[model samples]
Target chain A: MIEVVFFLVFFLFIFPFAISYVLASGKERLNIDLNYTRNPRYFSVSFREKLFKAIIKDSLLKGDSRIEVQMSKKELVKYGKFNDLTFNLYPNHIYVITNRAFRIKKGTAVKKEIYALYDLVIEDDCFIRAVACDGVCKIGNDVIIVRWIDAIKSLYIGSGCSLGIACSTEGILKLGKNNIFTRLYGHPIITYGFNEKEYKEFSTIIEKTIRENPVQLEGFEDKPVYVKGDIFSDDDIRLKNVIVEGTVFSFKNIYLENVIVGSPERRVSVIGERITFGRGVKIYGYIQANTKCGKVS
Target chain B: MAMGGIMILVLKGYIISVSLLCILYALRHLIFAYDRFMGKQKIFYGDIIDDQLPTVSVLVPMHNEEKVASNILSLLSKTDYPKNKYEVIPINDHSEDKTKEIIDEFAKRYDFIKPLHRYGGKRGKPAGLNDALKIAQGEIVLIFDADYLPPKGIVRELAVNFKDPLVGAVMGRVIPVNADKNLLTKLLDLERCGGYQVNQQSRYNLNLIPQYGGTVGGFRRDIVLETGGFNENVLAEDTELTYRMYVSGYKVVYANRAECWEEAPENWNVRARQVKRWSRGHNQVMFKYFFKVLKSPHLTFFQKFDGLLLLMVYLIPFLLLLGLFDFLILFFLGDINFIAPVYVMLIPLLFSGFGNFAPFYEIAVGAVIDGLEKRVRLLPFLIFNFVFYSIYISLGFWQAILDSIKGKKEIHWDKTERFRDKGAAD
Candidate 1:
């Protein structure tokens, strides 16, 4: 009786399972052949094995890859490398990503949304709007960044990477060995990082560096900007429908027309010469100028 | 006494012929399987030398096509063919409506728009095409139905295939623009997807004969004129043209990338009329080209076999209906013995099997390849389609065959009615 049951089970069960495995393997091979020119990381599992696996509660045949992980900030702090992973970053999400090493220093809240698909290494004391690193990236301290959509942003070595500008990447970004960043301004990226000895090989990369105080151009999307105090700059100061709380100084041209300076008792003054104002340019101050720039209509 | 012998002889021939057709139907599924799984992927050529592209003339045959004429003309004006090289000829086939007016307006606006108005002709698409053939100045003549919205690059894509000297004609793919209009249109959409995307594309990928649909396909002008142009008597001039081209050692290439969107019939009544007309026309083509397809030397043996099966696709329903008629005769003759041979018992099952599930298999395979497995759930309703086709398609096929034999005088080209969404005409 035992021998008969064994024989029946072997023929009816084990034999079919073995045959199915072979056929499923053949199907897997065919899938590989069809998608060989595409990304090999993606797999197309045929429906037969998938159906059978569903019937037998076999999760192995169904994919264990492509994990959808949701972790708390405390849990993420203890984690490292991820492969074929999509994360649900909810509370306490400090967005720092590296290839195999990702770290967010304590007390630095994340600013921008982080969607990582590349290998990245980010240090603490940073604010990133959004960064999608497709290649090796090393980011250091005291940086505030915004996200931009690109296919491959290869390598970034920003230590005090503050007020950085966008990079001109032709699909690949090659950086030199000693390419450390003190502060970067509204200038585009300069790839091919320099060696330590060849740091003086290049004259200038950044357009302007603001270290003393923050240059705020806030709420550009929804609201017009309002400055509260006196502005001192050696650049062209163009204003439209703006109220100045105090006097301006040394501007190349005071392009102000319908100016609304301080309170009626404490009206401020504009201290520059050249000014060409449109119909609604306003500053709540007085105009103390050497000469106006354009002819008034 | 001799009448009985003759009856027996007739019955024997019937069984053999019906069995042979059933086997052919089975073989069609086999080919569909091979195509769905094993056929090469269809390739599109994006880089073609502009200077080497031939000058082409496009013909749009219209009969009371006022609603669609403006849209079609607008689309044709935007086609990516070289401006000076291609001319649009809208053949206004004696319409009592504003089709001619629309074409005239277009011709007035665009210098390349040339209108061909036919006052009196044979009153069919083939006849309109024949009239337009005279004034078409290009080396190649492409045709589009009045309702098609050919994409910008479709014309260029179809024209590039003609760069191969051996290619005498080319056919492009079609998707339904109003596929979601109704259940009937939705089913028809899936069927069209199966027929074109899966079947025709696979046939092209396998180096088999891909059919030249009357519209969205072009042929060499001189070659078509040499083959005596479109036959006005044949309802399916496309099939007849396919045979003529193949017989003369020329290939009809299937351009899978050259896709155009067309409207499918939205109602069941309209869908029935459309399918019946298709069946009748296809049967006429089958009867006309049955032997010519067999004798074509340009085709491989497999191609010849596949072509013959394709030719007889419309007549399969009739054969199935006849199989039932044979069973009835047998039942009356007291041959309904349960103790008969297993093969004899399985005959009805075979016919019903083909009638019931062959189309489902085709649709399922097509849905799989097209990533439309979600729609495969709707396939159980094919029984209703089977019953309807077995009756109506069989009637249409027989009528077409008898009409050919008896030389029926009046063959009307029944046009499918259009449902226009004025806002979405663009």
Candidate 2:
């Protein structure tokens, strides 16, 4: 028993040390592989030549496309440049690539906000409305508007789209290109679902409207829409003057009044006043419109 | 019947000896736990509110340390302390390579750096330090080896503790930076943590003067000169000076917070050389001053006892070995039974487990977490650290015994290899 104890004690201290020593020595031999060295002189020459030729080619193809601007504290502006370029703003810089290909290296931080206006080859074609804004704002690539009808913030109206009177979108609003609306009469508010409880009391008014004119909401059935109260993404997305919201996956010619339209998945909601449909509405979720009919007979 | 009785007596003696060793090992663990884990050692960065910030001279003694010399200079330049209040005096003790050239480049770039080139190869680090001490203009002299990369706030931290007039020396914690590089570095890191975190902290808490580690230590320039600078003849100048400071009625305090990272030996060959030097130096100091410490008029009885204990710590591994051998004899004779006292093994096992594995795991986890969180690439190396370290430390112990037995007392300065960008201004 004593011998066993002795052996254990000896092995405990000595064995670990011996193994470590051998491993360390072996590692020393292996560490040579970690040292990476290329022919620096040859590589440098080739790199410099390639860089010079690329710069010359870029300048010949594009006009002097460099934009320089100074930005003060909290200043925001939009640029409409379509060339390979660099912009050195005060305290920060923004670069836009409108030609061939550009790569933003990983592990590098660009300390400025950038808005890519046009779809270059690398970036996908999508309407980026209010890409950088923190205030009540309206942004569009098309259409002009008059005052008092309600300026829209948080509503993303894409190219060649128009909004009618008495319509207001407050929460996250994403619109696809060439979608038009005719005379939206009430505030269509979209908000987070958790905060929907506070607005649920007001939802009784909507319920009452549906009960009173149940026949008017016929064509609004099964349309994809979002309720104002759902945890959209990670954060609770809330909007005022827009109680309910939904996404229209397929394009439809429609008109209706004071009703909520939602998707089958219940992920999107649309609340509007007096929506009309020119053709048959193929809906996905719950939709409530003022009146549903095949024709006005 | 008489012959059987004689055999039984011998067997019983062997069993008793083994039992005593096991008990001692167990007790050592208990003391280690009480001292290291539950010990009331505060590791906070103290305030440096004093109006007068004294100029500090960082003396780096180098011998063929070309590899790491550039890195040391670069790190020194980036120190968060005021540039005007500090000067780096890198004493190049006849480096055979481009160490002088590297120091010269740094001197040209930074006015605070002065390269003190010694022509002939010095026998050891003390000679180089002594040469640099002549022109050292700082009120406080901080010593760092070529391989050390002191953290930004270290100088200020060490400076704040010197407010106590009676304090002769302040020892900073030296940690292994390349701990994940291999098993050897990992073990060295653990050993360092145990020494700096546990042993040194315990001694400091108990108000006992702990030995100042060579690197990551500071001393009052006046006080160092008063004691005739460093003893060049002694193998371990740091240990010898620490004892001398105690004899002069000055306090040696260990600052657990002020940290500097050092490179551990990458290979066993370098590890063996470094360990042999440390062992020989420690032995020399013990032999030279153990009795002197006891008889000194300045030392208290408690201090004398502590010093003696400190000196005897070097012998623990050897004693443990002997104790194991003595236990083995009785076990083979069948005088002692294992089942009766199974709990005895638990004590040493538990103690050794914590003492060995805790620091290793802590450092490995720390490296991994830091790497994952902070994006430092050295995190993956933690896995192999344990196996590498055990080898280095065990070899160190073996080398210590071998050197002592062979009377190899030559002061050979083993230089660590550096892995920083050479062309950089640092």
Go through the candidates in order and give each one's C-alpha lDDT. 0.59, 0.51
Question: In angstroms, how far off is B297's CA in candidate 2?
Answer: 4.4
Where does candidate 1 stray beyond 4 Å?
A1-297, B1-17, B42-51, B339-358, B408-410
Per-residue lDDT over B107-193 for candidate 2, one digit per residue giving the tens place of the 0 to 100 score: 999999988999975566788888788899988889998877776667777865554455678898877667667655655655565
- Lowest-lDDT window of 10 residues in candidate 2 chain B? B370-379
lDDT tens readout by residue for model 2, A118-224: 22211222222212222222334333222111222344434443332222332343333443443221122221121222223342223211111122222222231
> What TM-scores do the predictions have?
0.58, 0.51
lDDT (Cα, 0-100) at B381 in candidate 1: 44
TM-score of chain B of each: 0.90, 0.76
Which ten residues in a row are the worst by lDDT in model 1 chain A?
A: A26-35
**Position A167, candidate 2: lDDT:** 26
lDDT of each residue in B1-426, candidate 1, tens digit only: 688668756865686677776765666665765776775454332222223367999999999998889988998988767888899999999899888888899899999999999887589888889888988998888999988887777777788666545678899877777765555665666677667766777777676778998898999999988777787877778888887888888888787667788877887777677668778888888887889889877889978977887787777777767766776676576654453233342443444344323355666677776665445555544545666766777877977978788987567888888887531554
